[model samples]
Target: MLQSTEHCHIVRNSEILSGEPIIRGTRTPVRAIVEMWRIGVSPEEIPQRLPHLVLSQVFDALSYYLDHQVEINEYIEHNRIPDELIDPRVRKA
Candidate 1:
């Protein structure tokens, strides 16, 4: 499964979640990447933040996101958190 980053097992198709991509074999939403980044988690530290994911998978997801920025951006925009609703703990205070 880790052999082909092209297989990109981290992506999945689902009826719900708007069929938005996800980490393969898990409902661990891919949107977490954007959320983490927004909250200042560096790309290099993503795997450490989510220990279940391999570093390669995290990097690949970012690559995929970059490659399909239009779609990923749309997804992120649609899922944007209202500033008022963001957890103060995560706020850039």
Candidate 2:
């Protein structure tokens, strides 16, 4: 079953992505949407890149990010590969 916040399209369920805020009815994390936007993927392009997500869902994810920057940033950092764990040759400059 899917759950929803009264103000947004984001949802959280313990069984889904370990309870990370995700687009309702999908496992796509809100952080994922923010990261794409941060990397210059426009809202218009997000749905094209992730066809499963409608424009409203992408916008909601971004709105959620704006309202909870620290939370989502922590999630991004926590899930990122540690620099030390990367092979030196494969690490970006």
lDDT of 2 by residue, 1-93 (tens): 456665378998889878889998788999999999998999999999999999999988998888889999999998989999999999989
Clashing residue pairs, candidate 2? Answer: none
Residue 2 displacement (Å), model 1: 18
Provide the TM-score for each candidate, comma-separated: 0.70, 0.85
Report lDDT per candidate: 0.70, 0.89
Q: How high is the lDDT of residue 32 in model 1?
A: 77
* Candidate 2 vs. true structure, TM-score: 0.85
Worst 10 residues of 1 by lDDT: 1-10
The residue-level lDDT of candidate 1 at 86 comes to: 91
